[model samples]
Target: MLKGKHEIMLKTSLGDITLVLDADSAPKTVTNFIELAKSGYYDGLTFHRVIPDFMIKGGDPNGNGTGGESIFGVSFEDEINADSYGLHKLKLGDATDEALPEELAEMTQKEYLEKQGYIFNDDLKSLPMEKGYIAMANSGPNTNGSQFFIIQRKAGTPWLEGKHTVFGKVTEGMDVVDAIANTEKGANDMPVEAVTFDVEVK
Candidate 1:
């Protein structure tokens, strides 16, 4: 197996894309990701969602945002508090003052509500979304599973910073991620072509 940080390379109609998984910050999520990759859970999967500012989501067994069963389900990982890990906020500026477009603003608020189950610290710190955030999608806290997303962009403010389970970040292959973001797609945001993936530990 590869050691330390590792890469999962793929061949998509959009070209080549590689994603680097961080083992340290998101041990469980990374382990699960590596396992799924090795099991070929991502083989022939297509990008299901492609909202430019949001993220490009895939890893579904059925090629739809809602598909994934056999090896695709994810149990609720622990809620990752940004402060607990001594992690600074990923948003920028006065975080309290900077205003973002409504669409993004709404998402930021929604992210906070999902994490309400956990107690929060009012003290603020500075952390960049680029630090290494692997955000999980969920109906509520401890409700996360296989489906996840990397923070391609930083949070607009700190109030919007908390609430997301950012288990890890990309240590390498940012170019690949950018490339995938730039790929052409169709339908409910599915990539026009297929995205097949395989994972292995180094």
Candidate 2:
């Protein structure tokens, strides 16, 4: 894992996971996470959404993937780009005109994305959404709150490159993540038994 100024110990019901956060690439997002963790905001939060080959998501006060707000009491913009982590060229999502809003239909993908408040940072590269990487979970553009996910897919979810903000990676205890991924899940991939975690900033 990359060396970073911020590290967090996530003590879960399953086990402990140590994460190293990159504030260089994602300053505001990292700051938001650290402040939230320090404020006891993530205590008792359950990993509400767990997919076997995907990720385990949590930090929702509602514990149902629909709640929690940032310390600023508002959503924040994404600090990422379409090309990073060795991805040379742009590999965009389904940004075809038909899939875009009517107002964005005539604009280029870059224009549409920028219009939605996503800033592309070329100087500081963001980490890929691969195994052990930790990132924010959002409903859409700039909607990041307290929700976050840990990547479990060893190959990584490349399609998420330009979408989510990957601020850190697990430096230890990935077995704990694997164990949580194996937990039985019900509707919406919600764990049948609650899997809770607390954060300790270091």
Candidate 3:
């Protein structure tokens, strides 16, 4: 079982980047990530998506931003900080502008939100989605798998707060992340030249 915090070293073709996973805050997600790394699941996986001002994403075995699975072969719920949302706030900042249904106000926050299709696993500390922030990428609520991304810009991405699970932070080598993010890319935001990874959990 994972205890306390853990550090992961990601040796990329661009450079080495170090990540600090908050196992206490996101136990399941952190465990999944560590297991994947230890099994060499991320070896040779290319950074399939890169947006200069946003983030760099990878962990897709197919290297095309299309394929990957959790060690459990099932999707996991998000570990988000509920406090990030003010007690009275009702809507998310995304394009959907999804808001709490008035009819479900009587239900608890978790129940009401789950009824709305949000699946949260834990209510831990919230990490600002600023540069170097690392988080899982999902299609929607509770779809977290192997795909993950590192925020590349210094500005905070408020729209992402509470929407995705922020499980780790880049404790060192942000410059390497910036380099990968700034690299040339072809179609589908894929790097023109492959930027592969060698992940290790320590």
Q: Which has the greatest lDDT?
A: 2
Tens-place lDDT per residue, model 3, 93-141, is 3234456455554444545456667755445665667889899898888
How large an RMSD does model 1 have? Answer: 6.7
Model 1, TM vs. native: 0.63
lDDT per residue for candidate 1 within 5-55, as digits (tens), equals 656665554555455655555555566667776777766676666555456
Residue pairs in collision within model 2 = none
| lDDT agreement with native, every candidate | 0.52, 0.84, 0.81
Per the 3 Å backbone cut-off, how many clashing residue pairs does candidate 2 have?
A: 0
Question: Cα miss at 146, model 1 (Å)?
Answer: 1.7
What is the Å distance of residue 184 in model 3 from its true position? 0.6
Candidate 3: where are CA atoms >4 Å away? Answer: 85-116
Looking at model 3, how many pairs of residues clash?
0
Pitting candidate 1 against candidate 3, the one with the higher TM-score is: 3
Window of ten residues with lowest summed lDDT in model 3 = 86-95
Q: Model 3: clashing residue pairs? A: none
Worst ten in a row by lDDT for model 2: 88-97
